[model samples]
Structure formats: C-alpha cells, structure tokens
Target: MTRHHSPTARLAARMGSGLALGALALGLASQATAAEDYRPQPDQTPIQSSKNESFFGKTMDYIENNSYGRLGVLRFQYYGSSSNLHVDNATGLAAQAFGPGGSDLPHTGSSAGNTTTLGAMIGLYLPKTNHHLAMEVQLAPPLKLDFQVSGDAVDQSLAPTALNGANGGSIPTGVPPLGKNLGTFKALPPNFTIVYRPWTHTLVQPYVGVGAMYLYTYDKDVNNKVLNAYGEPSLYLSKPVACVGQLGSDFNLPNNMFLNLDVKYVGCADVKSRVSNIKVNSPTLSPTFGPVDVGSVSSTNHFRAVLYQISFGMHF
Candidate 1:
C-alpha cells in the first residue's frame, strides 16, 4: 500500500474524476429545468377544466366562449330565379275549339320561355335557438308568362275582318300582335325554414334547410292580342303553397356584418289557369255570317312549376 503510482496512471485517474463530476452537474441542471417547467405560472390559463373532459365537452366550451350573441340575425337578400311551367291538362269549350291542331288555335303544352327576374327578400331569424330557424318574405316585379302558340293562330286570330267581326265595327289596325306572349303577373312568396349548421367555430358557416312557401299570384295582365282573339278574354291563375329546399353559406365580416351565398328549389304543386271569352265568327267560317256573336267559351289548364333561385345576401 506504500508504493507510489506512476505519472500516466495518476493523470488517467484525475481525468476520470473530472468527467464524473461534470456528468453529475449536467444531470442536476436538467432536473432543475424540468421541475421549473412543471410548475404552473400565475398568468397561464388552463385549456381544459379537467383532464378527463371529452372532446364534445371541449367543443361546446369553445362554442359557448367564442360564439356571437344569440340575438336574432336579419338578412336582406337579392336573388334571381328561373321558373318553368308545364301544362298538365286542359278542359272546356275553348279547349275543344283549340284542341291541338284545331282550325282556330293550337294547343299549348308548356310555357315557351323562362321567367328570369331580379327579386328581393327580407328575412329574420326567430329569437332564441341560436339562429337555426328563420322566416323570409320576397317580392319581385312583374314576371312574363309566355305560352306556346302557332303562327297561323296569330294571323287568323288578328285578321282585320275577324277583328271587325268580333268588335262589331271598324277596328284599328297596324298594332303588332303579341305572339306567344300570353300574359304577366306578380308573385308574393313567404318561406319558413329550419337551418342546420355543421361548423359553428369558423368564420365560414355553411347550412342546409327545408321549408314551405305560399305563392300568391296576382295582378294578371293578359295580352291584348289574346283579348282581341277571344273578344275580351279573362285569365285566372290559382295560388299555390309549395315546399322549398335550400343550401347556403355565410362568411363573417367585420362589424357584425356577414355575406351569404344561397340556392333554393321550390317544389311543384297543382296550379290552374282558366281562360274565358266570347266566341265570334272567323274568316274560315261562312262569309255570309255578318259579325255574329257566339256563345261564351272557356278552358281550364292544370299545371305545375319548379323554380330555382340563386341569391346573394347581406346581414343587417
């Protein structure tokens, strides 16, 4: 035990002792840093109240904290719609005379054109229910309803002699006839819908809805050519209540304002149109007949139309 160690051995032992001390110091510093990180800070807010909280609970908490006020939203919408009308069946004496290739007038199966117009709607979400239900009312300018008619029907119905025979005197000429332009009318449609929202935490919220609408048609304007043809024809259209389906998305903007894009489909219902007028002697009839007034004739047509609408809206 009294023997002294060599210089190389002593150097190796000193080096190993220094390395063990350094490792011990590094480990202590790492433990101190981990303990500091685990300690909660005074200003830090917990993301969850409990570690066992479910994802649904977290989502609801987020929605409750971040949602806008539950007070209802009012929206003003500008929309355009295209409608198609199909004639199902027709009846009455006028139908008999004009029954598809008859001498007087041709049968009309459907509208010759589409009614494309600009419309406006005002909608309000019912208070409560987090803006999930709404009611909307819409108004549009006069819409033209063009029905199919033959060129021969136009010429024969508006002939000078025929006009005089129907009117019982010399009538004015040179006025152009409204060929296929049957009439025009205005519509008042109101809707009630229940909306569904999939993502409530994002700025862009998309939704779908199903509803019903009452379509009130009024202010009928029959073409003068039609009137002259039938010697004072009166037109009538039945009001219908139809189902509605819609899809849309809303984009939140600054200052409580939002922009919306929407599309809707209005389901078909039984709609009817009736035309009643006094029949008169035509040029094709015997020439000996002198402006003879015939009995009144009428025709009824049952039809339905499906309307498609695209709209852009703004929040109030």
Candidate 2:
C-alpha cells in the first residue's frame, strides 16, 4: 500500500534509503578484501615429496650437511707407552751407608729402571670451537720396574767373612761389588690433559697439552740376600704428583681411524722411601757390635720420567 506524504518527509525517506545502501556496499567490500588476503599465492604453495622418502633418509641428509654431526663428540684411543725413568740416589742413611767408603753399618740407596706398558685414552670435544679444544683422560696399567742399590761393600773387613758366610747371606763379594738387588715394583701413572689443535681438517694434526699426573707405586719386594740377613725388611715409597706437558701428532687414516705419536714430560718429583724392621744378627754383625734392634732408616729420592706413546684412535 502506498501513502502520500509531504515534500520534506519524502526527502527524509530518500536520505535514509541512500544511507542503508552505502552501509551494504561497505560490508560487501570488506568481505571481498578478507577473502583475497587468505587465498594462497604461487610462493606459498607446499613443496612436493616422493612417497618412498623416509625420516631416516632425511636425518642422514641433514647430518651430512652439518659440521658437528660429521666430527662427532667423543674419541677413544689405545696405546703402548715406554717410560724412561731416572731416579736420583737417595740421601740420609742411604748416602752415608752406600757411599764409596765402607763402614761397619747398613748403607744402600735405591735406583729405578725404565718400563713399558699398555694405556688407553678417552677424549671429549668442547662445543663451538670447531674441534680446536678437547679434554682427555689417559690411564695405564701397572708397569714393572726393577730397583737396586749401587755402591761398594758395606764393610770390607767383614766382607770376606760375610761373603764366605753360610749361603753367602752377608755382604755381596762380587768382583766390583755391584751393590744389592732390591727387587721389582709396579708403578701406575694416570693423567688428565686439556689439548689444543691448530688445524682440524688436515691430514696431519699436531696438538699440545698441559696437565697433571699422579704416580702410584706398590707391590714392593724386599727379597735382597744381604738385607734379609739382618731380618725381614719392609720397603715403603711416597706417592708423587706432578705437572706434565704433552706434544703429539695424529695422522689420519681411512674409516675414521688415526695413528698418533705422543710424548710427555713429567716434572721433577721428590719421592721418599723408608726401610724398616732391622734386627741385628750377631752372625752378620762385626765383632765389636752386639745384637740389638736398629729401628728404621729413611731416604729422599728425586724422580723424573718421560713417556713416549704410539696409539690408534677412532672418533665416535
């Protein structure tokens, strides 16, 4: 139904209709803009993949492209070491008694020989240094070392009687009197080092390290014929801890294996030793002496050692 109205009312009705149409057009434009924004473009398309490809294959590809994955984090090595050890002659009773001039008293100093042993090393690579720095721990089993006393006869006057005594249990009467044999011992040395490598990808990589080492000696054998005449003798040694320096080179081989030559120098260490349980045996003693307890004798010895090692290593 249509109703006639005044001119002013007709103009107002027209204005209201124009406003409603403008609002409807604005709503339609906003909807169109949002739809265009969500639509995928050429650059936003998903990449295609082969159906036969696997997660393991993708992981291996990623590892081959990464540096850390190629170099690994841990290394293991097995080696053989030859140690050249030099121990200075002991002091105290050892010096006075074992000196060139002989007296009617117990005198002898201890000397150590060199040894060879098997060893192993484990190393860890530090992060973010491109394999330039690492920490290593090296260990070896007990090595056998022979100890002896070096000097002239204890008492030249009683030397003849002692040499000719029962079972030759007195003084050693050899041509030069080559001292007394103190027997063998076992020494174990272990070290921890921080190593630096200058070149990582070279065929021959050289490294230098500084560290600390500890020496432990045990299984003492005091079976000397001359010392046993007095009584059962007990031998004791002080453990030494010292600083060590290392220099080494590694030659790369196939299949992640390497051949290494390493040299280490241990600083001078002072070691002390004691020999106890000395009972005077009248038979071996001079005529002026009587049977009595002589207590114990102590000596100070200085030691220095150099280790040369050849090793085979693998990275993991």
Q: Specify the highest-TM-score model's number.
A: 2
lDDT tens digits, residue span 1-316, model 1: 0123455864585477457644543332233221212221122332433457654454334333222212122232212222222222323322333332222223322232356666555554433334554444444543544533334334444333323446466433332333666656555444556567676447888988777766555555555453455455555666677777778777766655566666666665555554444334444442453333333222323333444444555443
lDDT of 2: 0.52
Candidate lDDT values, in order:
0.45, 0.52
Q: Give the residue spans of candidate 2 off by over 4 A.
A: 1-109, 151-180, 279-294
Which portions of model 1 miss their true places by more than 4 Å?
1-107, 110-113, 116-118, 139-178, 224-227, 278-281, 290-316
**Listing every candidate in turn, what is its Cα RMSD in Å to the true structure after a full C-alpha superposition?**
29.6, 29.9
Q: What's model 2's lDDT at 29?
A: 26
Q: Pick the candidate with the highest lDDT.
A: 2
Report the alpha-carbon TM-score of model 2 versus the true structure.
Answer: 0.56
What is the RMSD, in Å, between candidate 2 and the native fold over all Cα?
29.9
